[model samples]
Target: MPTIKEIAEATGRGKSTVMRAVKELGLRESGHANPDGARGALIIDAEGASMLADFLTKNVEAKQAAGEGETESSNQPHIDVEAIVSVYRERIDDLKAQIDNLNAQLAIKDNQIKELTCALDNAQDAAKEAQTETRRAHDQVVLMASAGVWERLTGFKGLLGPGSDMDSQ
Candidate 1:
């Protein structure tokens, strides 16, 4: 049993508001009038008061949870879209830079390949000239041997005219 003034002060509500709420609660048949019927105070049993307090606490908690859930759901799509766009932009920039680098490397490799091909052609020409010079020198060596200015190590010689030993053989 508490006075209206005590309930109002404890709950931070006005006395009239407390009295109204008490009357509303009386609909549950939980409140009672005083024995003498003089300025009757709201009387609630201990179990009934506990039940009412529990119900009020649960109701407030439910409302708060519902509000938080609505806010989170509303913002979820916006957050996901922003994150996806940001990652896509970053990847596109990275790929563009990589392509630019590859183009530069390709140009360098093309120039190097051209240079190597030209050098290889020049080397082949030089080798052909060297082989011609070597064959001319060998012909001179054989002429010197036939003229008796040089001696053949194997003593095998062939004449270079119509009477050549190779022709007869």
Candidate 2:
């Protein structure tokens, strides 16, 4: 983290100027007591420092370009091709990295979906097997009852026998 004073010194500007720029840029800052106990200093991170540097560079370049154009009596503004190319290259690289990250995340989600689909298929197979087993057990119970197995096992001559009231009716 760099303090406001350090940023001002590095940019060769006043503290108030740096402070105003920082505030206008919406840079993040934290307050900490200075070494000399002069209240608190606003500390900015590397990102904020870089932003300030870029701002100062652009401001200086604009002023210089304006002065040059005015002195030369030329209507065309000065264009720095190299600086523009460098900035574009940085942006392209940043976008490519983001694309790679998104692709990786998409692949992970696709794998998860495949695994879930397989699990659902297995669960469906298991449910079909359970239903078949239940049907088979029901058939076995019906056969046993028709063959008088219940009477042999429990020794109870029920009405479902050969000469029962149901047969007469």
Clashes of 1: 0
Please give, for residues 1-169, the per-residue lDDT of candidate 1 as tens digits: 4455543444344667555665566624544322224766554433333333333344446655778846544322112233233334545676688899999999999999999999999999999999999998888677756665333432334434466564464
TM-score of each: 0.42, 0.45
Best-performing candidate as measured by TM-score: 2
Tens digit per residue, CA lDDT, model 2, 57-107: 577577777787466545433444444344445556766888999999999
What ranges in model 1 sit over 4 Å off?
A: 1-78, 148-169
Q: Per-candidate RMSD vs. true structure?
A: 28.8, 9.7
Model-by-model lDDT, in order?
Answer: 0.54, 0.66
In model 2, what are the clashing residue pairs, if there are any?
none
Off by over 4 Å in 2: 1-19, 29-85, 142-169
